[model samples]
Target chain A: MKRKQVLVRIFSLLVMLSMLAACTPAAAPTAAPAAEQPAAAEPFEIAVVVKITGIPWFNVVETGVDRAAKELGVNAYQTGPAQADPAQQVKIVEDLIAKGVDAIAVVPNDAKALEPAFQKAKEKGIIVITHESPDQVGTDYDFELIDNVKFGQHAWDQLVKHMGDTGEYAIFVGGLTVPLHNFWADTGIEYAKTKYPNLKLVTERIPCGEDQELARQKTLELIKAYPDLKGIVGFGSLGPIGAAQALKEKGLTDKIAVVGTVIPSQAAPYLKEGSMKEGLLWNPADAGYGMVWLAKYLLEGNKITDGMEIPGMGKATLDGTLVKLDLIMDINAENAESLGF
Target chain B: MKTLLRRHEAYVLLIIIVVSIIITAVNPSFFSLENLFDLLKSMSLMGVFAIGMLFVLISGGIDLSFTAIATVSGYAVALALLRYGDSLNIFVIFLLAGAIGILLGAFNAAIIYFFRIPSIITTIATSNVFYGILTVLSEGKWLYGFPTWFGDFANIRLFTLYSPAGNPYGLSIVTVIWLALVLLAWFILRYTVLGRSIYAMGGSPSSAERAGFNLLRLNLFVYAFIGLMAGFGSVIQALLVQTVAPNSLVGKEMDVIAAVVLGGASLAGGTGSIMGTVLGVALITLLGNGLTLMHVPSQWYDVVIGLVILVSVGVSAYRMRKNIQRRVITETA
Candidate 1:
């Protein structure tokens, strides 16, 4: 009976410990006043949530958050799910709500999956600003670093310039259901058909699942299947890096032109060696900085309007609570070093 | 011959060869020496983890924390590299990682052994704790800009072969380490007393204790050894990717678990071999590579893998039952 009691005590203790561990927020709450108070007196406590943590792309985003926090005099910190899972992201937001954060900024893994959490944050009167996910419901504003259509067209233009407006090209997205990636692919393909009539898509946009290894494997298979494939466009951050590696290994660096969205630091070697001709991405740090800037803007009782210049991101146009900024940087050999992830 | 054919390892090897032939038929490039080396190199990281997991499985325990342990240990090495930069030796980095792994592994072993908690439940809970602590500490950051020597480690080739299409393929240093580890594990399992004790414990703990084996010490050693391997695997993974992304390796536990199971390791414990685990890793690597080459949609990949595992396990279980029935009948006669 004594042993049983001891075991039960230990079991409950274990359960308590685990609960405490799970509920521990990624970023400790800073002592700042609530969002309801007009803030000239205390720093605004804003939480920036990302899709996943510990990758170069999001690392850069955190740097921006730090810079914005220092410059804007806001208590801003970035946190996200350890992996790209929306449910985990929701739990983080719920914890933030309980902690009474002034505002929340996010780069959601799934826009719809995060809807309920965003709704709850808004209901709690926390200002919510999201980046990279425009279709997200229940956010104060959704921002895009580049217009999705124009971004696709930019990729198409690069492909045409390299392939000389002819021959076979392939498209790789993170996944079919990843709205942003598929948007780029669909727009690029449609633009290519009307503009570069001779250019052919080798396959329906193949999903690489945002994995570098999968992207490399798919690129290798595409090369074998289409032998004369002239170019490749990767829509996800890892897609271009993987495609470039595969082409380089196959000794087809000169034969195929690889263009995609990738971190400049990760793509520097390939960009220098000419395996990857170009990379397209808005500075993630800029987006991170902008998200916090906007959150603070709304908190201070400022209304967003078209043609209003915002710090870090210049001249944003408001379209039904979505802020669109055309700030995509084209990364090439000469500019790759300067771009910095 | 019949006995050899009936062996689980034989079945796994057959699946590997059959898959290879089919892939080669569809895409002749898959048959090249370069592709073969690429497949092996790709399997090397998972192969290391599988070997570690094989020990856990054979000892009548499950460890869901291997990937978490790997990430934590690997992150330590990455931070150490960044801190010391050119002043740090690669050997010291690996040593530090291994030490961290052992400590974490010992923690898991102690709790499970003392509290008598089912290993799977304890590990699942511990994995979350370890990962949670890591995330909080690192805040989901990545470590990049390693020394050039470390960056080049993954690509260090001993011998090179050119495919007909002129792609250069080579046996990487990482692959050499993986192969060496496999040999070492096979040696330990086949010849060491601790290895014998592990088998005994898996078969029946009471019997193992009656035979005068120290259960407490053996449990500690087995879990610690797995931790050491997780650390080693993490370093290999970091080198392969050339960047340490904290969250990148967490969900890969499924792949490692699947490889061990497919290699003929029974989850119920007491049955597994290093050769079987290696074959299993090779088969999985080949399946992914072959399917990609065949242009099978990425979405279908998971479904296909699930079916393959189910079918293989089903067949193996059937054979095991039939052999048991035969033994019972023969004994009565």
Candidate 2:
């Protein structure tokens, strides 16, 4: 009788440990299917793969994804590469698929490298969605959320409207080889050629490689290279923030205007300082939320038609292989104060 | 299989050649002299680190901390320039980076020697400490904007040689420096008693000790030597890239290990060639470039690299087993 009690205690301890081990930071996307589903329906599981973990951008997106998962009565998991590693991300997707996750969404480190993982997931009858901008999308990724070419053209149009379409301009790119950033740059350059033919691109390309200090250095170089440069277009999040710092350091806030894709909060302080004119970004939080909703909806045996009305997000349309969100957000000094941190 | 195993670099070279053909088939411009020069220029950075690591491995020790030390010291030099803002010479930064690398190496050696910790653990811990130091120094930010003089090595090429149609074909000064280091290392390993001792000790430390060798001293000496080489290599890499991201060389230890193993180093202790190590690094860089160019899809690069690693280890294991079986048979006879 005493041995039986001891065995029971040990078994209970093992169960507790296993539960603790399973309670990872990544919330499982396969729990609690909506009550509206048939009694026999199982919950859907989805994996959210980001560039790297422990960043504010990814953290916020995780929160939105988790919230959607909870609201829609599904399980969601948020995991990423320890660093921005394509190889690691591929491994994560493989693991997720092996574990029988319903779908996998990724913010790719390299577009071309991730195609096989996505293709394998599709072969397993799993949904593979990418949140890359159109310009940055690799031929391998099934589809991207936003068209980067349109994003670049739109950004340039806004910059033209801000700077009156006829002035010298420069670009602060993350890296010369970062495909997405290069796409934005190419499109911006094309726009410059077509619309503002006289706007000379100073130093050809400003590749900061996502280093804020390098971005600042490149910005200073731009200032020195084109003394009368009127506007700057930054490709990634860091480029504009770094450019803002360079402008502030040189006291050229009023002299040069800045614009790019970055967090509104990061751009707000600079916007307030008048070193940065404005910034643009898609609703990454909503994008995260949308992924969870889609994962759950598809898992519930709801077929993915061209026009799918989500619970609260209204109708989302699929343009061929692409899912269009039209989720762009523009931030300027006037309204930057109101955006959530 | 036997032929391929004997000439591992040939296998790698074939992969490179195959990849080049595919890339040229897709985008002919990728096969240009300029692109090849660019490939050489970029690869020389890791080439320097690989060469130093080759020495450490030949001596039966691993310096997993070298890249981190290089990055931390490189950033220190960057910060010093930022703090001094124009009073610093480009040469001074290189000196400072070297000093940091040497000090870091000595510190790692001292810990392993005194504490009797496994060299692997010591280096792994030091890797974290070094990376942490960089984070503290930069506060998770990056340091950039060195003067043109600091990065002049990136631009200078041997008398602007070009292809017949006038494309840039000459190698960068950095590649020339790396190749010189490789040659210098080759000579030392071939001629020097200390170099031979390193290999002997690696092959069998217990036998080396029985033969009147100082195990502790040699361990310290070898690791320190690797550190010094790593320091200089880091500066070259930093200068060539013209930027130092705090986390730039993270996880590159795996690449270093892969290169060494590919060069035919027995991780069980001794038996690797410096020439093989060079080929190993070249093959890896080539594989990366080739896979990307081939449009085999990005995900396949990892698969390809993983397969190469598996095959290399498997070949080594099979050869070792065959040798053991032969020795057993000879003794029985």
Q: Name the runs in model 1 displaced over 4 angstroms.
A: A1-45, A66-76, A94-103, A118-127, A204-210, A213-226, A248-251, B1-6, B83-96, B325-333
* TM-scores, all models, native as reference: 0.87, 0.57
Best by TM-score: 1
What TM-score did chain B of candidate 1 earn? 0.96
Q: lDDT of each structure?
A: 0.81, 0.67
**Ten residues in a row with the worst lDDT in model 2 chain B?**
B290-299
lDDT by residue for model 1 over A245-296, one digit each (tens)? 7787667899899998888877888899988998888888888899989999
User: Model 2, A186: alpha-carbon shift in Å?
Assistant: 16
lDDT of 1 by residue, B1-333 (tens): 135323899999888888889988887877877777877877888999998899998897878788889989989999988888788777887898899999999999999899999787777778778877787688667776688788666677898877666667789788998999999999998899888789889767778899898888988988888999999998988777667767667778778878988888766666788888998898888887787677676667778888888888779767876776777799989
User: On a 0 to 100 scale, what is the lDDT of residue B149 in model 1?
Assistant: 80
Residue-level lDDT tens digits of model 2 in A39-86: 565667777887765445566677778798778767675777546656
